[model samples]
Target: MSKDSIINNLFRVASNMFTQFNTEEPLISEKTKVILKTTEGRKELYKKIISNPIPF
Candidate 1:
């Protein structure tokens, strides 16, 4: 798959997981804004992807 498709899939899955388990956290959209704005946040996001890889 292409990079945009992969990122969209990540966002979709993250939204679903957030909805199922947590109601008190910030929306994924807001988090997405920050991740897009910061190098550090992007690095952390990469760590998350690396640690909890998707099965495909």
Candidate 2:
């Protein structure tokens, strides 16, 4: 899958998990926004992906 597809799938799963758990944390939304950010946040995500090396 492409990176965008992976990210979208991740958001979908996270949303489902939150609903299942009845979580009302604002931090989750805030973190999602940060992940979607256009600048430094994107760089941070890139760094994390490079370091972790997701196995497909």
Candidate 3:
């Protein structure tokens, strides 16, 4: 799968996991990108991809 697809899948799984536990905290967010990035601008695209507000 492409990078975008992979990120989306991650979000989907995370969102579901969060819902299972009933939390508003996003599974993926700016902070997560900051924490996961190992190189500059590498995770910037994912930041935009996750901008679509996930329903709670």
The candidate scoring highest on lDDT is: 1
- Regions more than 4 Å wrong, model 1: 27-56
By summed lDDT, which 10 consecutive residues of candidate 2 come out lowest? Answer: 19-28
Q: Which of the predicted structures, 1 or 2, would earn the higher TM-score when compared with the native?
A: 2
Which stretches in model 2 have alpha-carbon errors above 4 Å?
A: 37-47, 53-56
lDDT string, candidate 1, 1-56, tens digits: 75445555776787787778765766666758767457566566666777997899
- All-Cα superposition RMSD per candidate: 4.8, 3.7, 10.7
Candidate 2 lDDT, 1-56, residue by residue in tens: 76555565766786677677754564367766767655566556656776998688
Ranking by TM-score: 2, 1, 3
Clashing pairs in 2: none
CA lDDT, every model vs. true structure: 0.67, 0.64, 0.61
Residue 38's lDDT within candidate 2 is 57
